[model samples]
Target: MQPYKKLFTYWFAVIIYDLTVDFTKSYIKSFKLKEQMDGAARSGKQNIVEGSEGMQTSLKSAIKLTGVAKASFEELIGDLEDYLRQNNLKQFPKNNPKIEIFRQKAAVLIKKLSDFYKNESLVRNLSNLSYLEKYFNTSSVEEKVNLLLTLCHQETFLLNKQVLSLEEKHKTEGGLTEKLYKARVQHRGY
Candidate 1:
């Protein structure tokens, strides 16, 4: 389990959760609607963790769970995009100046969180000016969700690659049942 892989996804979920929980409180005046958002975030993180933990015993199940995680993130990202559209908020361009700043902040926060877990390589640092906590209250809900959508894109990229790897491994190596059968044959000297 690469820290930057599933671990990054988990942190991104936590980051979005933190942002949305605050934003929705004021924006919507209630937490009821956030249950759907929370579901997606929790599913994305939990599925990845479960899949990683089960990989040793069931690679196929792990792959399926990872796909589920990817889908959950996609669902959340889609909902955010729709919200922006319905509310007439523009999605920021990839090269927007604020995006660069947000990316820098994300890099720092991810690195710090990774370091707290003793996984420094989980992120790369490019700035030291400030963390998102300082800017959260000042930034718009649209901005926060837009930034999170960018991260969702990265997570999907990693997930697609991971699924491809899993598929290839399953094709070449088969599954646990086949391995168990082979082990049994070897033990019987057949």
Candidate 2:
């Protein structure tokens, strides 16, 4: 199985990219902001994919790429925060009931994606973006921004956890170079 395909962070990054594209089209008038938002979202998704792909060969590379993904999402969150601040929109606090609801729903969506990947062989697509769109369809743009902010927070948290896990594994197992040296020594009957 492709490890990244099973990751909620990777799936959510894809969703963020698609939704940010659509969101910017309707709400943002500045081309620079639009491009930055889309690019950051895309970068987050791409880095996760690359990191997962490289994991077997080099845990260090995987860790670095995962860090890049986390940083990219951080940039996207900053852009979203700027958007809210500039427009004088209210961002929901961590303890808000609406944020709790969003977090619950987000967890469900992640589980759904994880199950789908486990049972099906399918290419990555925007098939699941509609779930998020429908979830906030009735909300105002400010609410949408809040939801996305909540999402970014969740994703960054997951990314950090993933990185720590990777670091621990790397420390225990060593990396590609160490493995290669061991294998070469064994093959030479050392």
Candidate 3:
């Protein structure tokens, strides 16, 4: 298969995985939890599709978008695990185990895409940066500085978004097990 096609397949797999997870999550009790999981799963697939749709005109941007999708998937998995543990339902065969399996599947897909894009061809190089610098053809030092700063801001925004998602996952996961355990015990009148 062609390289682009491979990328498309990867994105497609993510979309399918997300849909399946979302469907299964309907049986879950917490609406807030379900909404968060649904959002993350949708974001992962949407990013991939959106990026792939733009690949021909903006390869660098498309790859970056795909990265975002992977990051979203990672965050979703983390949150799901946390939710299960928080409810003290972590070891339950009906809940946590199935999610773990889905998480593993998503991880495999993420790893495959990461491996495929490890080369320079799919990324921006210093040469490309230089070209952009020259293309602007700005003679004033202040103007050059401004342009570079804008680029930096854009890059930083993307990085920070990914970081925030991961951190949210961590925060949500913590104390999840205790909460779940308590709820379970309470329900059991113990």
Best by TM-score: 2
RMSD of each: 4.7, 2.3, 23.6
Worst lDDT window (10 residues) for model 2? Answer: 119-128
Q: Cα deviation of 83 in candidate 2 (Å)?
A: 0.7
Q: 1-190 in candidate 2: lDDT tens per residue? A: 6888888888778767778887898899999889999999899999999999999899999999999999999998999999999999988899988888888887876777766865442224445555567765526888788888888899999999999999999999999999999999999999
Off by over 4 Å in 3: 1-25, 91-190
Error of 3 at 1 (Å): 13
Record all residue pairs in model 2 with backbone atoms less than 3 Å apart, i.e. clashing. Answer: none
Per-residue lDDT for 74-100 in model 3, tens only?
665566455446655423232444334
Give the Cα error of residue 161 in candidate 3, in Å: 20
Which 10 successive residues of model 3 have the least lDDT summed?
Answer: 146-155
Better of 2 and 3 by TM-score: 2
Candidate 1 similarity to native, TM-score: 0.78
Candidate closest to the true structure, highest lDDT: 2
Q: Candidate 3 — which pairs collide?
A: 85-177, 86-176, 86-177, 86-180, 87-180, 88-180
Give the Å shift of residue 174 in candidate 1. 2.6
Ranking of all candidate structures by their TM-score, best first: 2, 1, 3
The C-alpha stretches of model 1 lying farther than 4 A from their native spots are 1-6, 29-32, 115-131, 135-138
